[model samples]
Target: MTRMRIEGLLAAFPKLIGTGKQHTYVETENVRYVYQPMEALYLLLITNKQSNILEDLDTLRILSKLVPEYSYYFEESICKCAFDLILISLGHKENVTVAQVKQYCEMESHEEKLHRQMREDKIREAKDEMKRKANEIDKNKAIHVIYRL
Candidate 1:
């Protein structure tokens, strides 16, 4: 499904989920939300109605197991771990570990830092050029005023 629709459904999920004993799965007209509650958090899987419920549950089970192994604090960093987990789960990545994911995140962060530094350098160069042009303009104006006088 589209990202917006998925986000809409997820946004409405808490109301649909209710309190007390949670269900293993919740069904809508076109999608199913298979979730496993982890302490104060939830490990959710969104799948189409045509997909196999059993398989979805199994995937959720595996993810629920892996979540704890990768994250202990359930902070924002868990999002990156989730991405790696999804890649591994879909066979897009193989034999990956939490340490490997951390390395990958670090590499991405380093690249971003380099890009940011380059952008700053370019801005500084542009500002220097502007200042030089302004100074040249002021000198020309002074020379013209002296000649006119």
Candidate 2:
């Protein structure tokens, strides 16, 4: 639901601001949105309206730099993976350097990729188990019906 709303807001921006105007941030009553445009997509960050704009800009810059380091493609899945790396690099720091971000991204990306793979494997195993159980139950039901006849 939140993702849908963010995407909707992102889509609405160009129309609201006019096509030629470039906006780095948008502030509402309750929230502030900072976005960086890539080749095929926009990366958005949402923050409290009261937060410092300068800090937000710094964070946004750091995040945008990490994009090219992760993948050359701007597809949603690649973006998601890149976002994970960005989040990991940011950690609890208010400021970070390019080298720190790059190093952290490299160290964490491998672990995150492995974690994602394990999670997907578990989901797949669960699905296979459910299918097997379902088939077994169906077979038993058919056998009972035959015995009844």
Best by lDDT: 1
Off by over 4 Å in 1: 75-84, 87-149
Model 2 poorest 10 in a row by lDDT: 84-93
lDDT of 1 by residue, 18-80 (tens): 677657888888788888888777788877787787777766766676667668677565755
Q: Quantify how close model 2 is to the true structure by its C-alpha RMSD in Å.
A: 6.2
Residue pairs with clashing backbones, model 1: none
TM-score of each: 0.53, 0.54
Model 2: per-residue Cα lDDT over 38-94, one tens digit each? 777766777778778888888888778876666766576575674444353343445
lDDT for 107 in candidate 2 is 74
CA lDDT of 86 in candidate 2? 31
Specify the highest-TM-score model's number. 2
